[model samples]
Target: MADALLEFRGVNTYYGDLHVLKNVDYSIGRGEIVCLLGGNASGKSTTMKTIMGVVRPQSGQVLYDGQEIADLATSERVKRGIAPVLEARRLFPRMTVYENLEIGAYTRKKGPEFDQDLERVYQLFPRVKERRTQISGTLSGGEQQMVAIGRALMSRPKLICMDEPSMGLSPLFVEQVFDIIQEINKQGVTIFMVEQNASMALSIAHRAYVLQTGVVVLSGPAAEMKENEMIKQAYLGEMQVEAA
Candidate 1:
């Protein structure tokens, strides 16, 4: 894509003797909601880790806004506008909801912009505002997920990478979270998410990539992917069984 905001070219990552990502290539365009879908141990979380600099590729290019960033520190990447709402809603359990959101702005200098961004997060997640003084760990799973997303938005990111945003929530909360993701995308922040809920992800995504055993097996427009027989048999079929 000519306006690609993030691109991974020929990325190969390993953990000791176990190879996790193999020659993976993906391009997420500006203002797009791009999802990475896969089953367990398919290296989906590794992909998110590589993007966040938690894990480095042995060889290949990780470009953000056209600049190579495979070697940049996680803080540097965050400062450059790449924020991650990590898997399972990783939050400081002891901190209040508002305090956790404040930490997301660690890389930025405090000012009026901080207040504006905090308000923006509140506008997006009113429940979070309601629970601002509550300890994050005491909140329900769905409430914690909202705080996690709000924390990411506090950074004013141009791109937000979400890992399994629907991992552990009720069907209703999953729908609410997906709706918020769409709203976030509409407001112009590009999203690169790793999700097991293929149907929900594709329902909102502009494009998607399917990974299996560390390799990208399919990729294209979300509408086309939803209709792909291979996708139906492998991913959607499982979702159908669960729904039934």
Candidate 2:
């Protein structure tokens, strides 16, 4: 995986005495969208935390752009071009959309490039720009998700880790959210997402890893996974009957 932008090699993480991630290994190449899929309590969110440095692995490596960063601080990771669109769109409720987005650039100094990135986010999320002066807490759920994604883009990150981007959204919004994710990947930002919606995730993913009880049970190209009998039965709610 010499061309990979992010690599998790033999990563084993624990929560207290609980072994959360066991020898997890995966990679996301530059300009690709990779999804981690699993059911409830399957360590999908823990994988995202490990990458973001919020939860440290007991052993192994997290390499970003060929450099090891498992020991780096969370803020240090952000400075090195990792941004997260956390679950549930954790925006500053009392703050205006404009102010919330500006806070995302706190790791970088104010300058022309930073402002240009803000404009870039606005262009990507026109609804955000329209609601820039509005209170973030007051926007619709879908609009708030857009602002959360816009905030992540404001950081000008090389990689964006999204945790359950479609969670808590209506069917229409879920479709729209997936569309936006594909658009963002087309714009050249690598995406590593943790999702429970396997069908939606695989539709836009270049590759995907299926985690079961903290271990990777399946990994392959998205198109292949879509037709996999095990995946269809387990995640996509499809029934397959064997011929007698």
Candidate 3:
């Protein structure tokens, strides 16, 4: 797409002798919320790894803002405005909330702008602001998730790639997390997320792609995907009727 902020062209990845992503091609437009949905071992997490340069693709290109970043180091990718909220809310257990967030800005110069971005993150997550001095490991699951997101935001990234943001959270926290994701997208940060909860992901996503066994089985606008019979049956746990 002409306005694509991120693009995967013919991406193929492998783990040892086993193949994972299979010639995948997808794009996320500027200011769009795009979700990749799949079941376990369906290559969702591998895709995120490829984009973040955690795992380099054996073939093809991963483009960010029209630049080929497939070979850039993970930290370099962060400097290029790509930040990841990894799965399981991986925060420093021994660090204060403030320290954890400060670590997110390591790629940037320490100055007034960094402080400004920290305040922006705090404003977005008031709960995190209130617990700045507390140990991250002592927070509730929902609060830890908030800190994870706030830390990612501290980088001031143009694109935020979240891996299972709602994973392991309570039902109420899941709802709140998705709400915050929508609010973040509205504020002009493009989001690309990998999620197992198809129903919830589709609800907030502008577009979605379904990965099945390392291949893309479906792709379209979120509303249309929600109504798709196959998606409803398999991912949403609903039965679809056929005309007799």
Candidate 4:
């Protein structure tokens, strides 16, 4: 049966009394690729952190699979099928690529299933197979990003939230990153990402939300949002073409 896989209702958050996210209400349907769009400090990252339980919301409800999960711990949230790829590319610098991914699945039920998880991660990043023993710190920026993403997928979560996955990459690599996001979504992994690459986000996302200083100023189908006047004026720098 269809259901709202994740929901944030009237959520409010504060960083030491400085309000960050204000009454944010959003939801992601099962298997949907939704992009959260905003400039820096627009509460995009805060939203992801709040959902992942890294930052507790000062108010409002966070629901996952119809259960209120606002009170859960970070590890508990991961066990409940919510995994996040942070913008910081937080991989263990001294660890081998395989070791890093293995760590991501540390909370899983003990069994042969853990090995199976490694196989799944290798499938997504075949280069990971070639560099399984290499230290993540020595890898290039793009490779580090891959490790971060691969690690998140190691949990085999139903939803993956990536914060600015394309930041700090060469122009050539940016296209490759977007393709990877698309490929993952095609494999039926729901994605909720915060991306500053406006054009790429709108083109790839199935739907998107535009946040302005902790408020959702625009949201709709990806195609429609791509053409939105505010989005074009601010991000695209051109009006969207009408259907001919």
Candidate 5:
């Protein structure tokens, strides 16, 4: 908390009449991988949206780099170097991979910086480079995911909040995606991710938080979480009951 890169305090958010996030408290240190683990509708997506300023919080504060960012809108937040790769992989259907990534650099279009950013994203996702002229709608699900992540990276964000990066990939693709996420983090971006696959999330995360019914139920280092009896039984695939 004393040296957190991002912090959310008493954050409460709502959609119409339904309150989605209730007094949420979270923090991520610089260049750390922190995963938000929860079941369906446990407010994981809301956390990302709230941080991105897509959904405004009525009674809370979000601070990034020690400055309050709750007042900033979505575009403004992105301009401040926060990028999000959402669950649905929102890519321009008719646009080429290059075009999609170009949109991500809307805020950073200053001479050679824009060119360098494109090169960086292409380096991170060579699949996108190979498909530069190809329309995004025709790509496979895994390729689409790569485009989404690459588009986000084109912004050169200080923090990248990924929501369900492995939602609908094959086992191999899922592993590949997780590996890419780790690689992205290694390049000095603070990561706050939400994933349904607790096994994989815990395995890759440095620290993790388990949320249920919009509340944090557990918090610990990933190694301890991986060995946790409850986690091992429920989300990490069923394990034999240890000698009742």
Candidate 6:
């Protein structure tokens, strides 16, 4: 963890009288794919929000590149090389695909670098390029997901925090999206994802943490977690039942 890109040290977060995150500690090393796994009502989404500065921790530290960012604004966090692919693919419904992508770079000035980044996004999602002029709301679910990811990449992030990348999509699209996530990670951007699709997330993640209520119950290498009996019963087995 010497080269940790993001770290949470004994972090605790609350919403009014309710405690959402309880002394959580997480360290995401540079160039790694880390996933957070949990069921409904767990603190999974809260963790992502805490990192993005959407929610402030009541105590403990949130550090990025060794700098404290708990008090930073969301825009400042994005400016510091952290971008989020928020839950549910929140795209501007009235805007064209290209315009939605343009919004992603709001923190950066439009320049030659922006153009190059746009081309990179296009290369990653050719379908997005084809639909650049089309309204984002009109695109299919799979295509929308692609554009959501493309928009995140347009920020040129060092760490991409994704909340449920496989939330709603056909099986084919889910597979494609996960494949694209791996491809992006291979290009050296660290990924911290919160996913309900346990099997798919674990398959691609280097490490994973399991949250229950407001506490981390289990965490370790993804391979070992996949083989864990508790994990199988709690997550993978449930997935199989749904598939059945």
Whose TM-score is greatest here?
1
Clashing pairs in 2: none
Candidate achieving higher lDDT, 4 or 6: 6
Tens-digit lDDT string for candidate 6 (209-234): 99999898899999999999999999
Q: Tens digit of lDDT per residue, candidate 4, span 57-142?
A: 98999999999998899999998788888977889999999899888887786468877777876776777778999999999888
Model 2 regions more than 4 Å off: 238-244
Over the stretch 45-150, how does candidate 2's per-residue lDDT look in tens digits? 9989999999999998989999999889989888889999987889999999999999899899999988898898888788889999999999999999989988
Local distance difference test, each candidate: 0.94, 0.89, 0.90, 0.86, 0.86, 0.93
Better of 1 and 4 by lDDT: 1
| Candidate 6 overall lDDT versus native | 0.93
Q: Taking the tens digit of each residue's C-alpha lDDT, what string does model 3 give over 69-177? A: 9779999999888999988788999999999999999988899998898888888888999999999999998999999998988888899999999888887888889
Once model 1 is optimally superposed onto the true structure by TM-score, how far is the C-alpha of residue 57 displaced, in angstroms? 0.4
Q: Rank the candidates by TM-score, best first.
A: 1, 6, 3, 2, 5, 4
Displacement of residue 54 (Cα, Å) in model 3 is: 0.6
lDDT tens digits by residue: candidate 5, 1-244 = 3279999898888899888888888889898899998878989998998888888998888999999998888999899889999978999989998899899888875578888878887787788899999999999999999999988988889999999998888889889889989998898888899987787787789999888878888888889998887777666763233111
lDDT winner among the candidates?
1
User: Which 10-residue window in model 1 sums to the lowest lDDT?
Assistant: 1-10
Model 6: number of clashes? 0
Residue 35: error of model 3 in Å? 0.6
Window of ten residues with lowest summed lDDT in model 6: 1-10
- Global local distance difference test of model 1: 0.94
